[model samples]
Target: MARFFVSSDHIEYDDAGCAKNVLIKGTDVRHIKDVLRMSVGDTVTLCDSCGNEYVCSISDICNDFITTSVISAARCGSEPRIAIVLCQGIAKGEKMDFIIQKNVELGLNEIIPVLTEHTVVKFANAKDAEKKQIRWQRISEEAAKQCGRGVVPIVGMPDSYKNVIDRITSDDDTSTTLYIMPYENETDRTLKTVLYENKDFLNEGGSIKRICVFIGPEGGFSKKETEYAVSKGFTTVTLGKRILRTETAGMATVAAIRYEIGD
Candidate 1:
């Protein structure tokens, strides 16, 4: 069935206090009626974007949009077991878009773009930053839907390397049990070692709830940048002996985390 996101206010019901109708508006309406050619009595799924999925039957069709009467409300299909926030150094071209989309599919909870010392491409002004942010946000939303994510992952405004350090440390020190930064020079330190060193992280609970992964850009983080991260209490780990590309590093880290944590 087709799927679309709706607001809580759009949920209407019958005397039984069950959701029976939902009215779609704006572009959603146009997409449904004009694009999809869905007719009255057709079935579709309207989600609240807050993890609730309502199975609905189309009740009416109009020039503006279509209305659907809810059949049932249930949990969305794909929600990860744990939360992971990826703080990635911004890469050039559409690479960032590809990362955000795949990472969301891989069940990332948040994405933060960081400006590292070796970043090749830079946004010149505020206008450019705002535009890029908007684009990233749209990509996040589309990717969420495409992967049937319960909640949309945020593509936050880009931050400087320094600002990322300050915010994470100041915000909630206990939020992440392991703040990992994979370095090319850290040959002796492997992902397995990092997980083993922090095995106690899973002791308090049956599982660890959060982790912060720091990834570098094309030329990678400078020595000063890595030093700054270490100064902020981030544990430097190596993915392996081989140097990974900017795109490969973050995804590899995420996969390793999922495998180790059963997430």
Candidate 2:
């Protein structure tokens, strides 16, 4: 069965708040009617972006929308219990795209492209940044669909490293947010060590609800940048002895976190 994401408004709910039907509109209409060649009575899965999924059988297909009767609905099992956000330093060329795609597959909740001291790519203007954000979002959506993710991870606009640090550190509920930054120089603290030390938070019913992983660009974070982030409550940890690329660091960190948390 094919799976597609829809907004809450696209789902029709019964009096008891159970989903009864779903309306598939926009480009997906064409994909279903033409590309996939799906017809009435075909089964498809629909997610409402709120961690709920519906199994439906198509009842009608028209020019602009496809209507389906809900067969079943349940909480999405694929979503991780703990939300993970990747604050990655934007890489050059197509590396950023690859980063977004793999992180989505690993169950990341969101991504924020960070502009650091060593970041090589610079946006011409606000317009250029907007275009890149839009493209990154599309890549996130496609990856979500491909990996059976119930909710598409959001690709945030590029933000300065200091701003990101400030925003994350200023959270009112600091107890629930875990911030980890991977630096090559942080040899004493390994990711596994930190995770094991924080096992209580990673366990069920723990205070931690979100994890943020920060990765540096090609040339990596400057000493000043690393120290600033560390002062702002970000725990600096080494991924391993080997230095990983900007693209690989986020993915590896996420995977390791997921495995440790049993997500």
Candidate 3:
């Protein structure tokens, strides 16, 4: 069966707040009616972005929309126990797209494109940045659907390295956040060592809420950039002896974290 994400407003709820039906609109309508050639009585999975999923059977199909009756609803099972956000320095060309797609499949909760000192890609203006953000979001949505994710991971707008540092450092809930950066120069501490050291804190009564992983661009983070981030409470750890590419670094870090601490 196919899976699609539907907004809360398009879902009809009963007295008990259970989903009764769902209305799918926009590009998906055409995909369902023409591309997939699905008809009434066919079933599909609909996720409401709040980690709830509904098994819906098509009841009516229109030119511009599709109505489905909810058969069953439950919390999404594929979500990781701990939320992981990838703070990726924008890679050149299609590398960023590949990174977003693979990381979403590996259960990343969110991604923020960072403009760092060594970042090669530069937007001409704000409009250019916004346009790229929208495209990346679409890629995230598609990846989520393909991997049976209950909620599409968000791709944040491009942000400067300073802004990211400021936001994370200013977070009131610092106790629950594990801020990590993968630095090539950090040889003493390994990622596995860091994860193991924090294992107790991460699992203690479920107190650990979020894990933020920062990956550098092709040229990697400048020495000053890494120093500043480390000073602001971000732990610098080495992934391994060999250096990983910008795209591969995020995926590797995420997969390792999932294997170590995630469901």
Candidate 4:
């Protein structure tokens, strides 16, 4: 099924009438009229990012757009049990973009870029940071579409390492409270231990609904930072004995969470 995301404002009402016509604009207009070559009466799926999906049938085609009428509306598609939030130590160059794209596909709920003390790359100015965040957010949207995700994962504005940790500590405890960091020297236990031990932790309507995944930068999290995370109740678990690249850690942790929660 063809799927497109729309703002909640675009969804008027199904109670008003049986058929609701939808007018699409912007880049998606070009995609439907030109790239997809969709014509009048073609069926497609439209979603208001608030989790409502409408089965739509094109009713009219225009020079720059296509108008569709709603066929059905319901909440059918949604992420499964696991809700993962990735707190990644900002990396240099295109690595952050790569991380955002892959992690979104892997079903992460959000990405927080953390500026750590050891981070080598510096944003020369506000313009540079905005450009980088935009690039990463675009990659996340594209990856969401490719993976058939109902919603795009947010690429949050960059924050200091301390600020990121503080936010995690202050968040509600009704969420899944796992914090995974692939440390070099810490090998007390494996990821499998934490995951398998808490197999039933992701029960529906349970307190453990969200998970926090922490991935270090290229140089990895400083010893003091890791200690702070541990003090904040993060488990500081290892992926395995061998060290994985910064790019590999985020995806691996999300996958592990999904596997544990059946997401």
Candidate 5:
């Protein structure tokens, strides 16, 4: 069965009756009726974006939306216990797009486009940045749908490195928190070393709840910037001996963390 995400408001209850309804609006109507050719009685899964999945069967297809009766509902189990937020340095062209798509598939919780010291991409204005953010967010939603993700990961507005540091540290608890920045300049400290050493955070059979990974743009973070991040409690580490592209670094770190922390 095909799966889709719907806002909680799209769900309605029949007060006088017992049959709850799942209504799908907007472009999904066309997808169900025209593209998928799914008719009344066809089954589909609808997510409420709150980690809940509804098994619904189409009962009516109207001009504006598709209405279905809920067959059953269950909490979504595809989401990882850990929430990994990717603080990606905004790269030029479609690099951010690829980054968002792949990271969503890899179970990232959210993405923040950061303006690092060496970031080359600059928006024309606020309007331009807003448009780009919208586009990237849509890419995340699409990727989530394809990968059976229960909730679409949000692509947050681009922020400066300093702003990101402040936002991350504001609510972080030192004892359990893990904030990492993968840098090319760092050689002695490796990602594996840090993850393995932090066994306290990842206790036996206990999953990590919060992790933040930072990846620089093409030119990478400047020495002054790296030092500033390190000062802000971010553990600067390397992926390995070889260098990886800006886009690859985030995904690699996400996968490694998932493996080390037990996805």
Candidate 6:
């Protein structure tokens, strides 16, 4: 079955305000009608970005829209219970695009690109920043759709190294967030061992609220920056004996975590 995500407004209500049918509009009309060549009575999956999903059947297909009658509705099974946030050091060219796509497929909850001391790319103004953010977000959305993700992971505006550290380590933070930074210099604390010691697995099972992984640029994070991050409670861990590129580190860390705790 094909899957799509829509806003709450797409759901139609009965006289008593209960959901009756789903109204799919815009470009998807052509996708179902022409691209996929789906017809009435075909089954499709729809999710209202809030996480509830419906197994719907096409009842009518019009030129402007498609109507789907609800067959069964339930919480999306694909969404991970433990969220993962990737704080990536901005890579140049198509590298960033690859990172965005792979991370979304790995079930990341959010991705933040950061500029560090060795960053190769620089923006002259806010306009450049906004445009890049939009493009990256679109990549994330498309990847989510392609991978059958229940929700598209966020690709946030680029931030500075200091800003990202502060953003994740604040007391006003409602969600339980744990930080992991992979450093080549560190040989003692492997990511696997650190996660096992720091995370819950016995009483509550291997349940993590959120895991934030930081991957520095090609030159890697400065010693001062790594020390400051450690001072702010970020754990410095190792991937292994070998070194990984800026793009490879985030995906590797996320995949390992998902293997450990993700259902």
Supply candidate 6's per-residue lDDT for 70: 84
Q: Which lDDT tens digits does candidate 5 get at residues 1-263?
A: 79899998888877864338988998888988889999999999999889999899999999998899999888999999878999999998998999999999999999999998899998889899899999999999889989999999999998888998888877745445688999998989999999888866676554456788989999999998889888888999988889999999999999998888778
Q: How do all models score by TM-score?
A: 0.89, 0.97, 0.98, 0.90, 0.93, 0.90
Taken over the whole model, the C-alpha lDDT of each candidate is 0.83, 0.94, 0.93, 0.78, 0.89, 0.86
Candidate 5 Cα RMSD after full superposition onto the native fold (Å): 2.2
lDDT of 2 by residue, 102-150 (tens): 9999999999999999999999999999999999999999899999999
What tens-digit string does per-residue lDDT give for candidate 3 at 1-263? 89999998999989998789999998999999888999999999999999999999999999889999999999999998899999999999999999999999999999999999989899999999999999999999999999999999999999999998888778886888898999999999988999899998778466788999999999999999998998888999999989999999999999999998855
Cα lDDT for residue 255, candidate 2: 98
Colliding pairs, model 2: none
- Candidate 5 residue 57 Cα shift, in angstroms, is 0.4
TM-score, predicted candidate 6 vs. hidden true structure = 0.90
Candidate 1 structure quality by residue, lDDT tens digits, 1-263: 78777777888878988777888776778877778888898998888767788889999888876788888888876776667889999999999999898888888989999999998879999789878988998888778777777677888899899998788767754555468899998877788788777776744463466788999999998999999899988888888868998888999999888777666
Q: Supply candidate 6's per-residue lDDT for 145.
A: 82
Higher TM-score: candidate 1 or 6? Answer: 6
- Lowest lDDT 10-residue stretch of candidate 6: 199-208
Ranking by lDDT: 2, 3, 5, 6, 1, 4
Better of 5 and 6 by lDDT: 5
Candidate 5 stretches with Cα past 4 Å from truth are 13-19, 172-176, 204-208
Query: What lDDT score goes with residue 22 in model 2?
Result: 96
lDDT of 4 by residue, 74-156 (tens): 77466555678899988877788788888887888889998887887788888888887888887887787677777778888
- Give the per-residue lDDT of model 6 (tens digit) for 1-263: 88877778989878976667998887778988999999999999888877788889999999998999988788877898878889999998999999999989999999999999989989989999999999998899878888888887999999999998888887554246677899989999999898778656411444447778899999999999999999988899999988999889998999998886634
Off by over 4 Å in 3: none
Give model 3's TM-score versus the native structure.
Answer: 0.98
Candidate 1 Cα RMSD after full superposition onto the native fold (Å): 2.4
